[model samples]
Target: MALAATVAGAPVHAQDSDWLSYRDAYRGMVAFEKYGKPKQFLQQHYQVGARDGSPLPVDFRLALSGKTMQLNLPLDAVGRAVFPLLKAAYDENAVLTVNRKLGAYVFRPRISIVVRPDGVYEGAELRAACEQALDFQRTVNAAGYRDKHCVGVRFTFAKKPDADVRWKGGAPLPAVPGPAFPDEAGNAYSVVTVRFDAATDKGQVVSQNAPLAVSPVFE
Candidate 1:
């Protein structure tokens, strides 16, 4: 909640130079789609953020526009959107636009472990999922992720008072205010982080409420 500022304080405007070419974005997204690796537990999304890597405003959006195509892209809590690979938009040379000044925002791909519908996860499964994500990053040439280890996972919940997350048959985990994904700039959410050290790696994490997303914590 505190991590994001409302758009009401920031004027939303359109600048020609701020638009991103759809063709270029398509190529970047296709690379992940074509990657052949052990990534069943991982997922990829197109994320929009400020050029300066600052936190995104609440209700932020990225739109796809062209001569004959117009669609609004909805963003998750972390400014990630499910990028649509539309052939029609590509043929029309559509551009991705946002309501911000020139050079204020950028778009990039984000990969993370998938969230389960049941809101329950095995510690070992989470570690394996993180490994899959890390391996995918290395193969894609993300030098920053190469040497890091999966130390934990972060569960981001909605801004509600009853967001409960804890270890199974145990007390609730400590809730902190932070971004859903590490290094992501956006509005803050209620987060419960679980570390995978020896004492804490054998139990199942249970979430009484569904989380918006679950991100791996690498260190």
Candidate 2:
């Protein structure tokens, strides 16, 4: 599986009784709902793209202030790793960072999505103006970024990875070599990531349906 190529540290395998799959479990979540509990946080994904809906090297660590550290898996690979829970304490107003290795250096690019009473966020505009400082380092990267390891980091929206960002929903995300997310500044960043205001999601329901079908869409 493509995700098997990307997972780190843990060997997540699907068995007759156990496996980790995110997109299927999430998409069919509606079929399993028996109770609805109000939640401040919801589960969503960081569907990056070489364009807008792609995945990155399986090695990058998408850290959310240690509250959640993700390896931005493709929808088909969520079982390998998932931030199954999103809490207001863990996500709201927290600074999110992407820590990855390029040869001998570690680059930490950051952003914060603080939910305001007015529902506004710092980098919702996704411009260099929205780029956060790299507390992990004080030096510009080999790429020559001044303060942050990135400048052109940007974002666009799409249907949730649960449905749209899949190998079958459209173009199969290539494990191609290039900046994972295209830079508006056109710099060749070694890694890029996406963020969601978990506290503002549509929330989940109790599933009553059979287990989700985790096969690759075109399989």
Candidate 3:
């Protein structure tokens, strides 16, 4: 909430820039923090991904630094970090940096469903969460989202073949190689996308291995 604000029309060019302005990133994210809507089941993360759709380096990490504060933000396998909303950092106009000299990387805010510790998720609950995300998206920037609809959720797992995501007491959901988050680069992981429909809405999804993240799919 302490981020100085920007919105849809803000520039996101990354052609020659090596680092991202934390003030700009915060402005984009503060909308979610200020949104008074149903978002209990969703979470936001600061994401850094390759601009050219290339796979991220194995040691990829984000750095949040300011005049008085220097913090290392470790990225998950998919390049997401739990962004710190610090008033001091905002006051000093911190910057988010990747490995020095690292280019072709872009930064954005990501929203996804909260992963449950038990690896069990109710289908209806998933639908509700997706709706909540979609609704909130419209409040800030409704451009492409104005006519879109939530169709399903995509669960991205580790970069391996044996992800083991399936419907409760049913066959495994077919998974394809894809990125863990939207607009991300590289098909580095197995992704199982479950559609919201009568056959699945009343059931449950059981993930044998914990997913890196589950994102709502809008179409």
Question: Tens digit of lDDT per residue, candidate 2, span 1-219?
Answer: 122211211122222221223432232222212213321222223322222223445554444433344434323221112333334423333333334321212111212222223322233332222232222112223122333333322222222222211111224222222332232122232221322234213321111111111110000
**Lowest lDDT block of 10, candidate 1:** 1-10
Off by over 4 Å in 2: 1-46, 52-55, 66-81, 84-92, 100-219
Runs in model 3 with CA error above 4 Å? 1-11, 100-102
Q: Estimate each model's TM-score.
A: 0.81, 0.21, 0.89
lDDT (CA) per prediction: 0.72, 0.26, 0.79
Task: Kindly list the per-residue Cα lDDT of model 3 for residues 44-144, writing each as its tens digit.
Answer: 88776776666678877678989999999988767778888888988898888777444566567788899999999999999999999889878877785
Please tell me which model should have the higher lDDT, number 2 or number 3. Answer: 3
Candidate 3: global Cα-lDDT?
A: 0.79
Clashes of 2: 8
Q: Residue 210 of model 1: what lDDT? A: 76
Error of 3 at 21 (Å): 1.5
